[model samples]
Target: MQLVVGRIGRPHGLRGDVSVEVRTDEPEKRFVAGAAVATDPASAGPLLIESLRWHSGTLLVRFEGVNDRNRAEELRGTMLVIDSADIPPSEDPDEFHDHQLIGLAVLTPDGERVGEVSDVLHQGQDLLVVRRGKTDVYVPFVKALVPIVDLDKGILVVDGPAGLLDPDAIV
Candidate 1:
């Protein structure tokens, strides 16, 4: 099970260091030196983390053999990934992997079908993007609203306020 950790933003310095837009919650564990991460195109890597640093909220990393800015420039837009073995599972049982949450059926507490979860968008918090009929619904992935997740049954129970799942009300 591979997970996306970050994406190369731009070449940072004359050295091989490049800026990255981090997508993972635990960067210290994921972006450590000596760790090897695979790339998207499957040609840019598997990149070895030669060094790691933080500038503001962004991550800066240098890879072995990519010792020049020009070399790093070629890696812009590259995605960094790690295996499931490298990451720890969520402590909360109800919590889930993005892959697991995606595609689950969204329903009310009484089993009223709302839609299917198309995606899980995360910024500071997670939001479930649901495809309902001809429209899309964005539901906050909070414990209060999304109190139940029966993955085995392929269902997500939403108890949000009125108009949250209504396309006409939301849009």
Candidate 2:
């Protein structure tokens, strides 16, 4: 399985160093030097971690053969992937991997199908982007709002506030 671990940000300096928006919790294990990570577009590369270090709270990485800022800039916005048979389990029972939620059905408390989980947006809190007909709804993934996330059933039970799904008006 290819799991998304991080995204390459803009070049940090002139030495081909780039900042990473670490998506996985296990950065220490995933971002180790010499590790190979697949890129998003398929053509970019399996970006090898030639060097890895942390500055304050953020992680900085420099890939092998990418020796200048221009080379690093080319990789900006590219998602880093790691292929593993074992995706690390979430320590918190309530937490879930983005992939687990991505294609699940979204239903209201009354069991009406609202949409499908199209994407998982990670701001301060993760938001479930559901595609409902012609529109997209952003539902905050909180216990109060999304009470149930049943991976087996492939459904997310939401108790969204009025206008949460329909911004212009209540559904």
Candidate 3:
């Protein structure tokens, strides 16, 4: 399993360096020199971190064998992924990665089945998009609405107003 660590933003300077929008919590540990990371499948193989530095609050990185502006440009829009095992385990009981929530069944507080989480979106606020039948419903991933997220049981208990889980209420 691989976890996305960052996204290739754009070519930084002319020396084959690219600006990366860090996505992981531990950027310094995962984006160091000689660190093994994989970019988009378009690239030949996993990227070898040649060098890394912080610039203007973002990460400036150079991958091995990519030594020109053209090479850096080729990596734009690529997502950097690292082995999931490389990331340190989270100690927080309630905290979870978005990946873990995907595909989990959503249940209402009244023990009614609502839908399954299709994806977790972050647009200023966290949102859980659930798929029920052919329609998709968007629910705020707040403590008030989502009271319990049991990964072991593969269930997410929602506590929203009646009809909020209905497909017609989503539009």
lDDT of 2 by residue, 129-159 (tens): 9898878888888999999999999998999
Q: Cα miss at 76, model 1 (Å)?
A: 0.6
Per-residue CA lDDT of candidate 3, range 1-171, in tens?
Answer: 767778987998899999998876557777889977876673545888899989878799999998999989988889988766655656998777777888999998877887899987776787899999998888999989999998989999989887778887533
TM-score of each: 0.88, 0.80, 0.78
Predictions in order: lDDT = 0.87, 0.87, 0.84
Model 2 TM-score on a 0 to 1 scale: 0.80
Leading candidate by TM-score: 1
lDDT of 1 by residue, 1-171 (tens): 677879998998899899999877677877889988899878899999899888886788999999999999999999888776755668989778776777799999888998999878787788889999988888989999999998899998999888889988943
Between candidates 2 and 3, which one is better according to TM-score? 2
lDDT of 2: 0.87
lDDT score for candidate 1 against the true structure: 0.87
Structure candidate 1, residue pairs in collision: none
Stretches of model 1 off by over 4 angstroms after superposition: 84-88, 133-135
Which residue pairs clash within candidate 3? none
